[model samples]
Each structure stands twice: as C-alpha cells, then as structure tokens.
Target: MTEMLQFDFMRIALVMAVLIGLTAPAVGTFVVQRRLSLLGDGVGHIALTGIGLGLLTGSSPVLGALVVAVLGAVAIEVLRARSRSGADVALALLFYGGLAGGVILTNAQGGGSSLQSYLFGSISSVSASDLYVVAALAVVVLGIVAVFGRELFLLCQDEEVARAAGLPVRFLSVLIAVTAAVTVVIAMRAIGLLLVSALMIVPVAAAQQVTRGFRSTMLLAMGAGVLSAVSGLAASFEYDLPPGPSIVLLALALFLAAAAGGTVVRRRRARRAGEVVPGPAGPGERPRVDAEAEVISG
Candidate 1:
C-alpha cells in the first residue's frame, strides 16, 4: 500500500476510492430501503448523456453529468409521485434514451474510445480537479444524509406514514432523488457510470444480512463499502486488473460471506431454541418462511 501511495496518481485514486466508499452506501441505504435498488443505475444512464454532452462541447464531463443527472432524478421522482402506473415505463424510456444519446454524442465527437473509461472506470486516470469535485459532492451528500437521515429513513420505511407524520414527503423525496444523482456523478470517475450502482447497493445488501436495524445496517454498509473499495483498488493495482470490477466483485464476495455467516448464526440459534430447521424448499415452495419469521420475531 505504501509503495502504491508513493505515486501522485495512486494517492489521488486512493482518496477518490475512500470518498466514494463512504458516500455511495450512505445514499444507498435509503435506496435499498425504498426497494429502488436500480435507481442508481437509472440515474447513471442519464449521467452518461451528460458526459457525452460535455465531451461534445469540450466542457467538463463531470459538471455536465451532474446537471443532467439531477434534472433526470427530479423528473423521475415527479413522474413517480404523479403516476404510479407509468413509472417503470418512464424509467425505461430515460434509461434507453440517455444511453442512446450518450453513444451518439460521444461517437459524433470521436470520443468513442474515451467513453469506455467512463463506462467501466479508470481510477488511475482520476485527476486532482476530479478529486476536488468528488470531495465537494461527497460532502454535500454526507451532509444531507446526516441532517435528514431520520426523515429519509421514515420516508423509505413508509411514505404514507411519513406523510401522516407531517413530514415534507414531496420535498424529502425530491431531495433523496437529487442526492442519489449527485452520488452517481461523484462515483462516475472512480467507479464508472455503468457499475457505480453496485458500489451503492451491494454493500448495503451485505450489511443487511447481519444487521437488524436501519442505523446499524447503514453504518456497517459504509464500512463494508470502504473495505471493498480500498482492497479492490489495491488488488487491481497489484494484479493489473480493472479497478471498478475488482471493487464490485469484492463487495459481492462480502455479501455472499455475510449471507452465509448470517445463515449459520440463525441456524445455531434455531437449534438452541429446539426449532426444526428445514432444508431447501421444493419447486414452487416458499422456503424459510417460518425460520425468517422466527428470526424477525426474536
């Protein structure tokens, strides 16, 4: 690690990774709670259009992506709130339209080759300016999370309940969407637009495997995200691999490990309680319903 950090680029990459690690999961906690796990991907797709626009206009791709992504996120939330039936259709349209626009714009600018880097990620290429932007955006994300964490949690747990409790549901919803958009843009350089959602989501899922409360899951998810990002960045450096995929794969591995461990712990608890632990469910059978209920109840 020390050897890797000796280079200026490596140091920048490391800082970017850590910042991304910390912020992605913070927003992801709410995303997962609302079961909108694919929201990041959708916003990322839109951000790609912004990137293409930046490249075509010879402007800053990050700034362009931020603008487009925030607008797209707000549009999505408004549409979702207004018409539940067409939400999926609206998202699909944005997803495909943004992707197509990005490809066309990028190719038009002869930036086709450069698009791959944004699509997958190239942490080594992260510049000092990019780091500054990422840091600023990350601070915004964390600040919003810190100040509105409980309200967001309530909003995610149940929108109806949140509304009944006199929370500003519409405003809070928009804020969450906008926050997620910023997070996607912040992570785009280090993690890539296509794979950024994995960083946002997988750690939270992994954390959920062992945690029972919202706060615990959020905290653990951030820890898991940081560990995955740092370790994956180091591994990629040592192995001459892609940093984005390596980080996402490591996060997935952690999820699998956590799932296995949680299962083992649950089974042991069940045994001590003299409950019968059933095996895998048969075809068309719902498995572990009783066991899950026991775990939840306990």
Candidate 2:
C-alpha cells in the first residue's frame, strides 16, 4: 500500500478506479432497474472499433472509444425508437457487428503492442494524461446525473408514468444512454471491456440488496462501487492479483453477502410481523415481498 501510493502509475490507477467506481454504479442502478443491465457490454464492445480506429490513425485509444461509444449509444437509442419491439434484436446485431469489426480493424491495422490489454484492461499502465482525461469525463458524467436526478428516478421507476408526467422520456433516455456510454469508456481503462458491464451493474445490485429506498440505494451503490474499486486495487497491488478481475470479484462478493444478509433480515422481520415468510431465493434474487413493507402496512 505504501509503495503503491508512492508510485505515480498505481496512484493514477487507483484514482481512475475510484472515479469509475462512483460513476459506473450511479448510472448502473437505473440500468439494472430498467433491465438494461447489458447495455454497457454492447456499447463497450462497440467502443472497441473506435479504439482500433484510433490505433490505426496513431491517435489516443481513449479518444477513439469515447467518440465511438457515444455514437453507438446514440445509434442504440435511435434503433430502439425506430423498431420499438425489435430493440433487443437490434442491440444483439450491434454487439456482434461491433466485436467483429473491432477485430478486423484492429488486426488489419498495424496493431498496438497488445489489443488484449485494452480488452482486459491495464490499470497499472495509466499515465498522467490518461488520468486527466478520465477525471474530466467522470466529472461531466456525474454532473449530468446529478443535475437531472429526479427525472432519471421517475424514468427508471416507469417510463410510461414519467412520460405521462411530461418528463421528456425520450430525451432523458437518450441523455442516460450518452452518459452511460461515456461512463463505460472511462471504466474501460481500469476495468476492461469484458468486465466493465459488471462494474456498472453489480455494485448497484449489491446496493439494492441492502437499501430499501431508491435514493438511498443509488447513493449506497455509488459508495459500494468506490469502495470495491479502491479495496480491490489495494488488494491487487498487495497480493499481486490482476486488477480488473480482482476488483470485479470484490464487487461480486459484496453482492453475495448483501443478498444473503438482506434475505435473512427480511425473513426474520416477516416472521415477527406475522407475514408469510418464504425461503430465501438464490443469490442475486430480490425477495418477492418486502418484509419491512409488510410490517409497516400491517
């Protein structure tokens, strides 16, 4: 820990991780709640083509990923709006196309020292300039979310109602999509393409297990993301584990613990409240009924 703090690269990696940890889950709560948990995955893959293009042109991969990810996210929203019923099909098509194109473009180009590193992340390789870009993007993404928090909550709760309430549902959704894409690109530096989606959704899921209110859940999820990334980075440095997967494992563990503990607490509360308490569901499952809510209602 001491040595890592002394090193600029480690410090940069930790800072980037913390920023992503906070930013990813903030948007991820809405993503998971809306059943769009895999949106980041598809966008991350699409961003790979951007990275390839950057490398081909001898530009920054981060720049490439940002532009491409944003465009891809916009395209997704456009396709969703156009197809309505076939949105999932369109997304799947985007995912595979992005992946295939990224590979062909990356290989056909002169190629970098290693594209695998980008796909899997190289947190320790972060530089000062990279850190600056990440910090700027993180601030912008978090700022957008902060400014429109209430609209986002309403939208997440139910699009129809949000629309009925004159909340500009389409605009809010597109805003979310663009923010989410920017978030994924930033996290891709620390978490990698394959695991970036997990960073976005898992911390939110863990927070959901522990918190009852949407507002609290959102805050807790961001906290969980930050803690997971920082602790995971420390552990990776101290124990010599790979950083990306290490951080993901820590977040997963938190989710499991939260799920089990929340279930036990709810079951006991239900029993005391004279409600029908069912057996705990599998890991990651939300209880069919909220025991505390039943108690309050009773």
Task: Find the candidate with the highest lDDT and give its number.
Answer: 1
Model 2 misplaced regions, further than 4 Å: 272-298
- Per-residue lDDT over 1-298 for candidate 2, one digit per residue giving the tens place of the 0 to 100 score: 7888998899889889889999999989878877788889999999999988887888998899899999999999888778878998989999989888888878888564457767877767789999999999999988988899889888988999999999998889899889889999999877788789898899888988868798798899999899899998888889988777888999999999999988987777767757444566445555544654464678
Please give the distance, in angstroms, between residue 18's alpha carbon in candidate 1 and its true position after superposition. Answer: 0.6
Please name the candidate that would achieve the greatest TM-score relative to the true structure: 1
Q: Over the stretch 85-165, how does candidate 1's per-residue lDDT look in tens digits?
A: 988898899988998999888889888777988998887778999999999999999999999999999999999999999
Each model's TM-score, in the order given? Answer: 0.90, 0.89
Q: Which ten residues in a row have the lowest lDDT in candidate 2?
A: 286-295
True-structure RMSD for candidate 2: 6.6
**TM-score between candidate 2 and the true structure:** 0.89
Number of clashing pairs per prediction, in order: 0, 0
